[model samples]
Target: MEESMRECMRKLALWHTRTFKPIMTHDELEPIMATLGFLGLPPSASPGGSLAWKEYAHSSSSSSASSGGGGRARPRLPYPRIDGLHSYTYQAFVDGVSSYLEMCDISVLFHIRGMPLHRLDLYKKWRRMQEDESVFVYREGTLDQATYNLYHLHRRGGGGSNSGDGDYINVKMYYGSGDGNGSLVIRDKGNSAPVSCLVPLKDIIL
Candidate 1:
């Protein structure tokens, strides 16, 4: 039953992050608490079920479950604290999801020329990708700006690296005609034995 309680609280923690609002009001929290109140009861557990069976099964202990002719009310159930951090706060919730999430760096490949004239823009690319099942997308716990910058297209690797490191994090479409990206011509500092090659943009075009 402790494990069941932990599992439900973990989902609540996830919801708090998904809404991008971690601070919940007392009234807002009441329903969630009430839902969890019966987790150890007969409707929720199995035969000879749980170590927590006594706590939630005893209706006399809880005001919500008790008759009007009641004795002292029992205290609220403790926070599941599955992450082992005694505190429950926004940072703790963020840490929990970050740990739970399967994170990876993204590489975006796109072409603007194929878009319909009526809706000609880069933002459409994001919307298209969102609808594509092949593309993996997830919502952020907090709102953020979508900052896409237009830069002179630079081929990451034709024969060799463009930057100091061989790794490249970004790839972009050339915005204008007669630009550098179509066959990168790299020359040594001494301007000797210039290397030229093309990183094809055919895969990106619709």
Candidate 2:
């Protein structure tokens, strides 16, 4: 049941990710390109579509064939695409940005640092999610900070955030090929008894 639930969440995040409008192609952005051409400036480093590809590929069968065969595969987008994912739209749904979520998809979740998102090469990612992403975050800070502060606030001992709600877990999928994943745990990070924040999205028949 837990496995199925995780898969469902992964798909939900992916389905949500694919629903958005894709990158705009070069032709669709012509007015901007024209202005760039006038100023003797290059177009967008990586405009969305096939035209952007042709620009770098140099079209082996066309007039630029002479250059295509010998030249390096240069990026046409001026800047790297990795630099473009900083916006909120690209944040994980767990982070409160539901639009272009990349976090929970199993292919992206089990391992860390997958890039170009479209390319799903499993071997490329070396670290497991738990190792890098499992640190708990509380409201304004981390689970460690929140709990420690709450402890002090109660005893009149130290400054605290005054609360212990785990809002927004940086969720990730667990994949074990069946070994380490089965290792059960009694406590979460910060050495505190774990709290289960998961809520059922929908259900019935109690």
Every model's TM-score: 0.15, 0.17
The residue ranges of model 1 lying beyond 4 angstroms of the native Cα positions read: 1-21, 38-206
Q: What 10-residue stretch in candidate 1 is worst by lDDT?
A: 105-114
Best by TM-score: 2
Question: How badly does each model clash, as a count of residue pairs?
Answer: 0, 3
TM-score, candidate number 1:
0.15
RMSD of each: 24.0, 19.2
**lDDT tens digits, residue span 54-102, model 1:** 1132232443563111342222222322111111122222222222221
State the local distance difference test value for candidate 2.
0.23
lDDT of 2 at 70: 38
Candidate 2 residue pairs in backbone clash: 45-77, 45-78, 46-77
Model 1's lDDT to the true fold? 0.23
Off by over 4 Å in 2: 1-120, 132-206
